[model samples]
Target: MNFEIVTELSHLERVCEQARKVPAVMLDTEFVRTRTLYPRLGLIQLYDGETLSLIDPIKLDDMSPLWALLTDESVIKVLHACSEDLEVFHHYSGVMPTPMVDTQIMAAFLGHGLSTGFAALVDEYLQVSLDKGEARTDWCARPLSDKQLEYAAADVFYLWPLYHLLAERVADAGWNEAVNQECNLLVSKRGKTPDPEKAYLDIKNAWQLRPQQLAVLKKLASWRLREARRRDLALNFVVKELHLWKMARFDIRSLDKMVDEGFDRFEVERHGSRLLRMVSELDTLPEEHYPEAIVRLVDMPGYKQMVKEIKDQTNAVAEQLGVVPEFVGSKKQIHQVLKWAWVNGRNPEKMPDLLSGWRKAYVEDRVLPLLK
Candidate 1:
């Protein structure tokens, strides 16, 4: 309940000035994300084991000091389940916190669970329960209540102690560098933008479409992503992904047909014609421009056998590594490895993340051979 609310640049500087001297800092952010493509930051919390400061992102004009402290190599920035926090930091600062330790990832390596909730870990480790009543409050709104501020401060209050406990286990297990590498890999993902042109490849059931239909899907998908970004709306808010797929599949030729098919009129009126027009232009394109048909990993012959072999080998390697198999190579990561080896086999220019970094350190000699 005791903390400083930093609203001015000078106050933020003062806090960051003191925080930089500490070897490590606990960090968290409160943001409101309703339907927009980006999270609107509201508050930032920092604990240097001495001062608990709630930096008012809404009132603070300059966050350079915060960025400097965050990127400071000497000071470890710690958080729990930092995927979203990483997004917030990357969005506003255009850079991620450095030498970050996601306590959630840390716990996963220590065998607590793959995705442990912060409160659950706190209770399990510290025997203290957290109040999460303000979890859904509008963080961007002014005049935050005492309860809200308390909730915010509670986020970073116990992080240092929690980090201390987890770090010791991680160090004993000799996974400190692994945790650090995983956090860095997570940060690297935020730096890349999703290519609108390839958006259709990610849509469900996209593999069912033929090359010509896939071309239409590609145009529709591209438009949807571009429009979503342009309007700052959630992807589905612009045009539902299913609708894009359906529109491509049916090739509905007119407004009446599009409406008759039950597409939302607002969307039909706003984007239907443009989408249809884009698809029509596809007819003029040469055959080579169409994306190659998507290859479904599940449909490949020997897919089941390959997966079983890989899973068995992964479990073996995971056992040797003394961590959860999912931590080394999750179900998703296994699929990525399969896809990389089979679907993109000819493209040696790329490699799956599972075969990179600390994961590679463990599984490359052991598992990469199995893929070959």
Candidate 2:
């Protein structure tokens, strides 16, 4: 339970220097992201199996030493469920840790199932229960409570032992290389912000819109995301998704119509005119310029049969490998592979995710031949 609070540059430099000597170090971050697009990093916990240090980024301005340590290839950075931690590090430092080992990935490969919580892993491997009460605390606030510090420290403290256990188990199972590649792929996928033009694709029920209506929805979705990023505000704070879809759906012209269509009164007042202008300007667009009506995969010919065949084969592979089916392939990933197979005027450069990285060995021989 004893840990050092590193708040000075010299202390951080010394800590990183010492950590560089280790073969691997446990790492974790505590941040707040209630409303903003980017996480506000609060504290960093690093444990080299000997020195458990809580480095306060709020106190230090120059984090070059820590950043260098993160990018060091000789030292593996071990983390549990590190998706957001990867985002926080990539956004804040502009670099991600290398030679990474995600304990969650190892656990999944070891048949614990994907999306396992860190506390759950710790309890199973280390026989210790973690207090998750501080999960919603304001991490950006100064003078973080001892309870908060203790909670954050616990994130990395148990990781050291758990990494050892899981790594050995994964290696003994002969899935170490797959685990490493999965970790690498995980790092590569972090921090990919979609372009504004394609932002509308993420809207739910967007496919129901007509071609011209889809065009208007695209414009609003683009503007909302652009404004959100520019102002660091949440997308809903700028304009609710319902507002965007409604503003585009029925082709509301007047501000009153907007409010009638369930647009928040404040949003209508603040953005109604701009939104109406975007829709009105589209009136001049040639019919050919409008986006094509979205074609849902379920509505496509042979989509259900293709999905069923692939899902069945994937399940067989997972059963043979003695792993969770989710670890083999999730529904989203199946859709990615199917969409790539279709190549119906989408990005030509994008490869099927199932045909790449660790997934390829499991999928290419067993399942993808069906697509052919």
Candidate 3:
């Protein structure tokens, strides 16, 4: 179990060259996202059967060698709960690891917990207890201690064994294709950049805003998204969501008024004029340019009963599958399905993730008929 810290370019190139020859590689990443829209990659941990290596992205200038190994579709990349890790890779190299296998998804198909943690899976299959104290460590900081290095190495060490165990169980259960298909979907989703125009939809109580106010919120959210990306700052650091909602809902005309309503001085000084201009222009926009108001399904008659029936059916399916109801289909996902089927004039084929791929056979069959 020898672990080598790779900080030089030649050493990384040699390691990646060796890793490319392996059938599979266990991988993990440590990143920080406290102040930026994208997570800043700090370290990469890799275990290619024989050698365990830690790559310091902070010290290395070029990671193209490692990225080449990651993008090699012929080699399998084994990871546990790899959503954020996939994001890190996409941000760094503009490419995602292909032929990837997520043990968490495999565990779900094998009748284990759907959102099982890495340490939990290790303890379950290999009887190893991992110290996760370094889970929140500032990996971007230099001069990492020996104990921290060991913890990072341990993250990917047991993944190799866990991948074997989970693959065997999933294959035995005849769910090999299902797990692979789901992991492919995970990779596809992680590679997509979100539409900044739709960021306002994520705001709480957004449905309560009027058509004109929704238009204002949309513009404000888009501006905030661009600013965050351009400056590499968190969205809140530019302008808090509460203030955005307040500006949209109320008739705050001037900077003084916004400051009186408790907007941050820095935000007021930076983007206050832009916000005011956007709000003022909302009135001049034509009626057709306004955003459509979000109609809550609960407000519609008989929709409550429809929601209850769908929840009961999803729960029954979860019970039949021996997994949690949330795992089968969360409440939010069910609502999205209903919105598509009823309001959006879309069919089950056009529905969201719940009715697609492997989920179609399990959940959609029971739920679609009721919606129709």
Candidate 4:
């Protein structure tokens, strides 16, 4: 339970030096992103088997020492449900921790369940309950309370033992290669800048729009993404998805029309003209330039039966392997596989993730046959 509250640069360097000697270090980050496009780091917690260090990112002027330790491949970095924590690290160091082991990923591979929360895993595996009272604390605020520090320390404290337990389970299951592949993919994907042009695909009810409208949606979504990042504001705060969908579906001639359609007054006043201009430019798009219609599988005649068959085969194979069907292939991934199959004349060259790597052995063998 002995820990240090590190607020100075010199102390952080000394702690990192000590941490380098450890084989593995448990890592966690406390950050806030309520009003910003990027997560604002507030605290970083590290437990290196012996010392639990609570490093205050808010007070520490430079995090280079800690960043070096995190990016060091010699020492394995351990985390639970690491996606967001990885993002926090990327925001600070512009790179993800290497040779990382995510207990959550290991838990899923070991039949613990998919996307299990950290607290739930701790309770289930170690029979230890974690206090989540400080879950919503303002991490960027100055002078963190003793209770907050204790809660933060607890996040990394159990991680060391949990990592060993999960590692043992993965080894027993003989899935070390598969688990390592997944962890590597997780770290590589962290801090990746998403394609703005593809942002339109995430809008709900987007499939209902025509090809021309889809083009407009793509442009509007791209604009929104750039604006959000440039202004460091939430995407929804800049312009809600609902408004985007409405704009794509309807013909709004002027800014006045946009306001009537439930667009925020300030947003309409600020960026309404640009949105309209983007939509207007889409009118000049060539016929071949328009985006393809997103045809839902259910709407495609006879494809519904194909989807069901694939799901049944996937589920049967998953059950036989003693794993969840979604773990083998999620519904979205199944749909993607089917879409690729249909588009490519039933060729299996570009199969989805479920049909690749270790998943192929469990899922593709059964599902691919159904697709044929």
Candidate 3's C-alpha runs over 4 A off are: 347-349
Residue 44, candidate 2: Cα error in Å is 1.2
Best to worst by lDDT, what's the order? 2, 3, 1, 4
Best by lDDT: 2
Query: Clashes per prediction?
Result: 0, 0, 0, 0
* Alpha-carbon RMSD, each predicted model: 1.7, 1.8, 1.7, 2.1
- lDDT of all predictions: 0.87, 0.89, 0.88, 0.86
- Quote each prediction's TM-score: 0.95, 0.95, 0.95, 0.92
Of 1 and 4, the candidate ranking higher by lDDT: 1
Model 3, CA-based lDDT:
0.88
Query: Per-residue lDDT for 310 in model 2?
Result: 90
lDDT of candidate 2? 0.89
Give the range of the ten consecutive residues with the poorest summed lDDT in model 1: 345-354
In candidate 3, position 94 carries an lDDT of: 92
| Residue 182 lDDT in candidate 2 | 86
Writing each residue's lDDT as its tens digit, candidate 4 over 232-299 gives 89899999998998888997768988988989998798889988888888887997999999977778
Query: For residues 1-372, what per-residue lDDT tens digits would candidate 3 score against the true structure?
Result: 589999999999999999999899999999988989889988999999899999999999999999999889889999889999999999889999989999898888766777889999899899999999998999999899887899999988999889998888888878888788889988998899989989989887889999988999998998899999899899999999999999998867899999999999998998899899988888789979988998888888888898888889888987887767777778888888878887878864566767887778887778878877
